[model samples]
Target: MFLPEAWGRGYATEACTAVLDWFAGALPGEPVVLYTQSANTSSMRLSAKLGFTELERFEAWGAEQWFGVWSPLTLSG
Candidate 1:
């Protein structure tokens, strides 16, 4: 979902949350992983908002990459 015009409108966050929620339900006890460039602040913020915790950081493709994980238990409490 790449929409420059839709940036900062909360659309990405909302859509991602809905998708993650549905996926959690469809596959209980499974974890979801996301990788994004560390320089992308918006993505980092969204990942945190979606209950993703940083698993590691590494240099990749000539840039820093952030690896995160999310799980139903972590999000639900």
Candidate 2:
């Protein structure tokens, strides 16, 4: 996660892309997942760019709202 003050500088997107590359190269075919709160539209968009699909919303930690599951194809180079 990143501080809200750091939004729009492409840090999350860039880091996610890099991490995706490393993970795919290191563990080829392994599954990956990312979950973020519902209010985090930025993160939701980031996940979409990285090919993450919203799997389900559940109340696990806080006030009931989360996104989950990212496809392995998201790690494509």
Candidate 3:
């Protein structure tokens, strides 16, 4: 997790992209799941930028949670 001061920077995006790339290479055709609270717009946006597709929304911990899936097969050149 990034600190408040680290928000808005590309650190998270860059780091996540690298990790996803490695994951895809290490496990071809595997899918990953992402979970974030609906209140966190930044995370939601990041997930989208990372190519995660919305799976569903559910109430948890008294707040709406977002669930998304990311599959290496969905990656495009």
Candidate 4:
């Protein structure tokens, strides 16, 4: 995780993209799953930007959490 001071500047986007690219290359067409609290708007936006689709939402640990999934095919043309 990066320091709070490093929140913007696209670093997360770049790092996450690189990681996802590696995962896709390693496992052809596997999907990636993500979970985050609904209250985290930044995470929600990030998930959408990363092409993750909402799979479900549930209550956990006294908070509303969302489960999303991203498939390599999502952005593959």
Candidate 5:
């Protein structure tokens, strides 16, 4: 997560990319899942950029939630 003051600076994207790369190297065939509020557009964009595909959307905690999954195989094409 990034501070509101740090929004739009690409920090989230960079950090997430690094983490995902590490996960892919460490867990070849395993998948990674991410959950975020539907309203958080930045997170949605980041997930898409990192190759996450939406698995489901449901209401929880009074707000819509997004569930996505990513795998190294998917990224490798």
Candidate 6:
């Protein structure tokens, strides 16, 4: 999802929400993971809005902090 110019427009949320719904139905009773930098407050908020729960926080790629495993419950179709 590379919308460089579409930042802060809710485009990412819209696109991700659709994908999440499809994936949830495609794989039922499983966990979906979404990872991003801890510094990216917008992404964190978006993930939360999409019902992704935090699993861990760690450092990676030299001085870059990351939040891992925004776990969302998969739905059965």
lDDT of 2 at 26: 88
How high is each candidate's TM-score? 0.88, 0.72, 0.89, 0.87, 0.85, 0.70
Segments of candidate 5 deviating more than 4 angstroms: 1-7
Error of 3 at 45 (Å): 0.8
Clashing residue pairs found in predicted model 3: none
lDDT of each: 0.92, 0.75, 0.94, 0.90, 0.91, 0.70
The candidate, 2 or 4, that scores higher on lDDT is: 4
Residue 70's lDDT within candidate 6 is 34
Model 1: residue 13 alpha-carbon error in angstroms: 0.7
- Model 2 lDDT per residue over 4-27, tens place: 888788887888878877887788
lDDT of 4 by residue, 8-69 (tens): 97887788888998998999789999999999998998888888999999999999999999
**So what's the TM-score on candidate 6?**
0.70
What clash count does candidate 4 reach?
A: 0
Predictions ranked by lDDT, top down?
3, 1, 5, 4, 2, 6
**Candidate 3 local lDDT, 1-77, one digit each (tens):** 77999877899899999999999999999999999998999999999999999999999999999999999999895
Report the lDDT of model 2 for residue 38.
Answer: 78
Off by over 4 Å in 4: 1-6
* Full-model lDDT, candidate 4: 0.90
lDDT of model 4, residue 17: 86
For model 5, how does the per-residue alpha-carbon lDDT over 1-77 read when each residue is reduced to its tens digit?
67899888988788888998898899888999999999999889999988999999999999999999998887864
| TM-score, prediction 5 | 0.85
